[model samples]
Target: MPTPIKMPALSPTMEEGTLARWLIKEGDTVSSGDIMAEIETDKATMEFEAVDEGTVLKIEVPDGTEGVKVGTVIALLGAEGEDAGTVDAAPAAAAAPESSESAQPAASEPPEPTPASAPTVAPAKAASSAGTRTIASPLARRIAEKKGVDLASVKGSGPNGRIVKADVEGAQSGSAVPRREAAGPATGQAAAAPAGPATLPDFGIPHEDEKLSNVRKVIARRLTESKQTVPHYYLTIDVRLDPLLKLRAELNAALEAQGVKLSVNDLLIKALAKALIQVPRCNVSFGGDVLRSFSRADISVAVAAPSGLITPIIVDAGSKSISTIATEMKELAGKAREGKLQPHEYQGGTASLSNLGMYGIKQFEAVINPPQGMIMAVGAGDKRPHVVDDALAIATVMSATGSFDHRAIDGADGAELMQAFKALVEAPLGLVA
Candidate 1:
C-alpha cells in the first residue's frame, strides 16, 4: 500500500507553511526519523522528518510552494515490495475519474431546474437533509469563497460528487447561491469602521509589488489583532542610568579575565524580571473568564530578524544572573537573526521587553504581545540635565515605557511595576543580588 506524507504542524499556532525544499527524491529509500523536507513556518525554517520507513513514490507538492495548509499530502511513500510505478499509479487512479469528469463538464446532463435568478433555498435544504459532507477541492473552495457562492447550494458534477474548480465557476453563472455574510460584531458592540483605500494612485510611476513572507504576514496579522482587541494603556518613566552604567563598567572589567561581558539591555531584562516578581499583579495574562499569573518571570526579548521582528524568551530570567542572561540572549538573538529558533525558544512568556536603545531611539511605546499583560520599551541612555537633591546635575537618563493590557493590568499596578523597574535600574544592586 502507498502511504501519504502530509505536512506536519511545526508549532501549535502553525496553520500553513511553505514547502521550502525536498531532501528526498522519488525512489529514494527513507527510514523513520530521516529528514525528508524543509518547511518554512511563520517563525522559522524547520526540517521535516519521515515517520515511516519507505521508498519515496512521488512528491505531490514541489518545493517553494507557499501557503501549503497543515495536513496537506505533500508526498507519497511506498511500502516494502511495492513497485514505484504501482505506488505512483495508486493516487492517480483515485483522482483520474475526477479529473476526467472536471475536464469534460459539458458532457454531463445540464443541472435541472437551474436556479439562475432565484434563491437556492431548496437545494441547500436538500443538501443538509442528505447529511453528506461537501467534498470540494482546495482551489474550488477558495474560488467559491471569493465569489461568495455557498457550496451547499451547488451540486457537484465531478467523480464521487466531488466539487472542483469548474463546478464552482459554472455554478456562479447558473445558480443564485447566496453570498456569505460577513460576521456581525458582538452584541451591543458597534461594527468596525470601514477600511481605508486599499491602494494609492500610481500616478504613472512604475513600482514593483513583492509578496509578503510568512513571518511578515503573521507579524502583521498578530499586531493588528493585538492593537484592535487589546485595550492598551501606556506609562512612561525616566531612570537615571549613571549608577548602572558605572556598575556595568566595573563588573565588565572584573569579569574580563573570565570572558564575561554584559550590556545595558541585559541589566534591564533582569530588572524587569525582578520588578514583575515584586508587582505580581502586572505579571498576568488575560484568559477571558480567568487570569493566569506566573510565580517566575519568563521574559521575551524582541530581536529584529531579516524576515520580521521576533521575541525569543529567557525562561525564569529572574533567577538567573545578569551575565547568564546576557550569554543566553546573545545565542538566542543570533538564532533569531538566522531564523533557527525552535518553538519553545520563542513561544510563551510572562512579559516582554523591546529595546531600541542601540538605534538611539529616545523613547517609544510598544504594543503588548498577548496574552502577555505588558511590554516594556527601553530607549537609549544619554546625558541629560537633571535635579539631584534639589541641585542641578547631569546624569545618564533613559526613558522606559510600559504598555499594559488594561483588561489584565490596572493602571495603578502598571505604574507600580514601572516604578519598581526604575528603582531597580537606578540602584543597580538589586539586579546583581
Candidate 2:
C-alpha cells in the first residue's frame, strides 16, 4: 500500500506551506526521522521529516509549486514494491493514509480499510511533471517575479522553512542575500529605476502597489490599532546611573573569568521587572472591562532583525538571576538575528522595553505594545553634573521614558512606576537581590 504525504502545518498559524525542496527523490528509500523536505511557513523555514519508513513513490507537487494548502498531498511514500500510483486514494483518505502507515500495522501488514477500496492505478501522467526545484509561497515568488528577483537567489527567512516576501526584499536591498549581476541588466527584468530622473514618459510596466511584507503588515496593523484605540500617556524620568555603572563594572570583573559579562541593559531589565512587582499597575492591562494583571513579569525587548523589529520575551525577569537574564537575552538576540524566533517566544509580554542606549541616543519615546499596558524607552547612559548631598558631583545619568496606556494606567501610576525605577537604578543593589 502507498501513502500520500501531505504538507503538515509546522506552526499554529500556518495555513499553507511552500514546498521549498525535496531532500529525497522518487524511488529513494526513506526512514522515519529522515528530513523529507524543507517547508516555508509565514514565519520561518523548517524541516519536514518522515514519520514512517518507506520509499518515495510519488510527488504530486513539483518543486517551485506554490499555493499548496496544508494537508494537500505533495508527495507519496510506501513500501519499495508498492506502487503509490496504484494505491486507492479517496478525498478523505488523502491525509489519513499518510498517517495510517505509522499509526497502525507496518507496510507488510496494513489494516484493511472499513470502506471498500477504489481502483488503485491512477496514472503517473496525472501527477504533475517533475520540476528542478520547489518554490515556496506563491505570493512571495510572484513578488520576486514582478521585481525580477530570482527565487533561487533569495534565502528564505520564514519558518520549516520556505521563502517569503521578506527574503525577497532582503535580497533586493543587497543586505541579507547577495545579488548576482554581470555589470549589465539582469534577466527577466526591464529597464531599471532611473539613476537620474528625467522628464521621460512613464516607461515601466504598470502594476498595483502593495504596502509591505507580512511581518511589516502585522506590525503596522498592531501599532496603528494600539495608537488609535488605546489612550496613550508618557512619563519621563532621569535616573542617576553612577551607582549602576560602578556595580556593573564590579559585576563584570567578578564574572569576566566565568565568560559572562553583565551589561547595563541587563541590570535595567532586572530593575524594571522588580519595580513592576512593586508598582503592579504598570505590570497590568485593561482587558476591556477587567483589569488583567500578571504575577510574572515578561518583558519584551525590542530587537531589530533582518526581517524587521521582533521582540523576544524575557520571562519571569523580576525573579530570574541577572546572569540568567543575560544568558537568555543573549540567546534570544542570537536567534532573533537569525529569524529563528518561535511565535510564543516573541508574543505575550506583560510589558516591552526599547533601548537605544548603545546607539548613543540621549532620549526618545516609544509607542506602547498593546494588551501590554506600557513600554519603556531607555536612553544612553552618560556622565552628567548632578547635585549629590548639596554638592556638585560628576555622575552618570540616563533618561528613561515610559509610554503608558492611559485607558489602563493614569499619569500618577506611570509616574509612580518611573519613580520606583529611578530609585532602583540609583540604589542599584535591590535589582541584584
Candidate 3:
C-alpha cells in the first residue's frame, strides 16, 4: 500500500506554502521523524518531517512552487518491496524549472500542459509622432500603447508642442492640463507658478529581483496593513539605572559559583512582567467590538536574524526566576538566528520588547505588533547628569519608548503603565518574589 504525505500547516496563520526544497528525492527511503522537505511560510523557511516510514514513490509539488494549500498531498510513500513510480495519486504539477545556468536548457525540459489559470499579458506597441517621423520617449509610448489611442490625434502645446514627453502622455492618457487659476495674493511680480515635476532619481538598479519568499511576502503585506490601518502613538521615558546596574553586578557575583549569568535584558523582562501586573490595563488587546485582558503576561522579545527580525516570547515571565529567563532567552535567540524556531516560539504575545542597547542606539520607538496592546523599545544605557536633592549628580540612564494602540489604551493609561515599569526597573529588588 502507498501512503500519501500532505502538506502540513506549519504555523497558525499559514495558509498556502512554498516547497523550498526536497530533502528526500523520489525512490529514496524515509523513516518517521526524518526530514522530507523544507517548506517556506510567510515568515521563515522550515522543514517538513516524514510521518510514515516507507520508500518515496513520487513527489507531487516541486521546489519553489508556492500557494500549496494545507493538506494537499505532496508525496507518496510505498511499501519496502513495492515499485514506487506506479502509485496512483493526483497528477503532480511539473516541477519548477531550475534557474541555475549549469542545468539543461528549458527547451530540453519535458512537455507540460499550460494551466488555463495562469495570467497572460498582451504585447505593447511603440508610439510615434503624428506628422513628424520622430520617436516619442519610452514612457510616453508605453502610456499611449496602454490607452489604445492614436498619438497623431493629440496637439502638441510646447515650442512645437514639440511632441515632448508630457504632451504625448497627457494626450494619450486623457490627463487634463490644469486650467490656470486666478493668481493668488502673490500675483504682482510675474505670476510665478510652482515648479513642475523634474526627472526623478533612477532608484532601481538593474539586478536580479528574485521573487519574494512566501514568508517575506506575507510579512510585508501584514506589516503594511498594520501601519496603514492601525492607529498608533508613542510615549518615551528616561529611567535612572545606576541602582539596577549595581544590583546586577552583585547578583552575578553571588551566583557565579552556581553557573547562573543574568543579563540586563533578563532583569528588564522581569520588571516589565511585574509592571504589567500592577497596570493590568496595559496587558490587554482591543478588539474593535470588545476589550480583552489576560491573566498571565507574555512578553515578546525581539531577536535579529539573517533574513529579518523575529520575536519570541517568555511566557509567564513574572513568575520565573532571572536565571531561568536568561537561560531560556539564550536558547530562543540561538534557535531564532538559525531559522529553526517552532511556530509556538514566535507567536501569541500580549506585548513586545525591542532592545537596541547592544547596537548603542540612544532612543527609538517600534511599531506595535497586531493584537498586542503595546511594544516597548529600549535604548542603550549611558551616563548623564540629573538633579537630585537640589544638586546635579551623575547617574546611568536608559531611555525606553512605548508604542501603544490608541484604540486599546488612552494616553493617561499609557503614562501610568510606563511609570510603573520605570519604578520596577529603577528599584531592582522589587522584581524578585
Candidate 4:
C-alpha cells in the first residue's frame, strides 16, 4: 500500500508555493525527519521534511513547479515491503477511497477528505444517481466551498474526471453561482484588476521583460495595500548626530576587543525601541474594533535582500543591550538575505525602522507596514550648518521621519514619539541606559 505526500501549508498565510527542488527522487528510501524538498513561499524558501518513513514511490508533481496548491498530492510513499514501481502504477482515483482502511498506518489513519476533495453531488443529481460521489482534489473542494459552487454541476477536467483547482476556479467564473463573501475583517475589499496583456507596443526597441518573483509580487501587493488602506501621516525631525557619533566611536573602540562593532542603524534601532517604551501610545496596532498596545518594543528592521526588502524583527529590543541588538540584527539580516527566515523571525513587530543612510539618501518618507502604528525612516547623517545656542555651527545631522498610522496614533502622539526618538539619539546615553 502507498500513502500520499500532500503539499503542506508551510506558513499561516501560504495558500500555494513553488516546489523549488526535490531532495529525493522516485525509489529513494527516506526516514522520518529527512529533508524531502525545498518549498519557496512568498516570504522565504524553506526545507520541507518527511514525516512518515517509506520509499519514495512516485513523484506526482515535478520539481521547479510554481503555484503548487497546498494539499495537492506531490508524491507517494510506499509502505515497507511494498514495491515502489507497483505503487507508482496504482490509479490515484481509486487509491484514495479504496485504500482508506488498508493503506494507512494503524496508529495514524489518513485524514478524511474535506468538502473540497469529497465528490459533491447536487441534491437532484444525488437523487438521480442514488450513491455516486463527486471526485475533486482537496484544493478544488476548498475553492468550491469558498465560491459556493455545486461540484456536481461543474465538469471535472483532471485525470479520471477529478476536479482540480483550475476546474473549480473556471467553473466559478463561467457559472452564475453566487460566491459567499470570505469571513474576516478584511473582507468586502474588491479584487485587484487583472494584469493587462503583456504585449507592449514595439517601436523598434530592444528590451528584456523579466518576470516578477514570488517575493517581489508579495512585496508589491502588500505595499500597495498598505498605502491604499492605511491612513498615513508623516512627522519629520532633524537630530544632531555629533554626540551619538562620538559615543559610538568610543563604544566601538572599547568593544573592538570583544569582537563587536555597532552601526548607527543599530543605535537607531535601540533608540526607536526606547522611544516606543517612553511613548507607549506609539507601540500599538490597529485591530478594527480594538487597539493592541504592547508593553515591549519589538522593532522590525528593514533589510534589502536579493529577492526584495524584508523586515526581520528584534523581539523585546528595548530590554536588550546595544551589542546584543547588533549581533541579532546581523544574524537575522543574513538569514533574510538567504531567504531562510522562519515566520516568527519576520512576522510581527510593534514598530518598524527603515534606514537608507548608507545609500546617502537625504530624506524619504516610508509607508507604514500595518497593522503597526508607526515606522521610523532614517536618512543620511551629513555635515550641515545648524543653530547651536542661537549661533550657526557645523554638525553632523540626519533627518528622521516617522510615518504613523493616523487611525491608531493621533498627530500629537506621533509627534511625541518622534521627539522622544530624536532626544534619545542626540543624548547618546539614553540608548545605552
The prediction achieving the highest TM-score against the true structure is 4
lDDT of 1 by residue, 1-433 (tens): 6887877888877766788889989889999999999889989888898999989877766557565666666677889898667753574533321121232222123322322433222112123447765765554655565555677777776434656567778876424333333333366433232221224456777876565789997887778778988999999999999999999999999889988899999999999999999999998999787899999999999999998999999999999998899899999999999888999999999999999999999999999898999999999999999887799899889999999999999999999999999999999898887
Report clashes for each candidate as comma-separated counts: 0, 19, 6, 2
The runs of at least 3 residues in candidate 3 whose Cα sits more than 4 Å from the true structure, single-residue gaps closed, are 88-210
- Please identify model 4 stretches exceeding 4 Å from their true place: 88-203
Candidate 3 clash pair list: 41-215, 42-214, 42-215, 43-215, 156-161, 158-161
List ranges where model 2 is wrong by over 4 Å: 1-4, 14-28, 40-42, 58-73, 87-213
Q: Tens digits of per-residue lDDT for model 2 on 162-191?
A: 566667666663221222322223565433
For model 1, the superposed segments whose C-alpha errors exceed 4 Å read 88-200
Error of 1 at 362 (Å): 0.4
| TM-scores for the candidates | 0.77, 0.69, 0.72, 0.77
What are the per-residue Cα lDDT tens digits for candidate 4 across 1-433?
A: 6788887877776766778889998889999999999999889999999999989877765566565666667788888888755764676542333112223232132432333422333221111144577866554654565555777777777544666667778774423233323222366743232231233555777877665767887887778778877999999999999999999999999999999999999999999999999999999999788899999999999999998999999999999999999999999999999999998999899999999999999899998888898999999999999987799999999999999998999999999999899899889898887
For candidate 1, list the clashing residue pairs, or say none: none
Question: Scored by CA lDDT, what does every candidate get?
Answer: 0.80, 0.72, 0.72, 0.80
* Candidate 1: count of backbone clashes, pairs at least 3 residues apart or interchain: 0
The 10-residue segment of model 3 with minimum total lDDT is 94-103
What is the TM-score (0 to 1) of candidate 3? Answer: 0.72
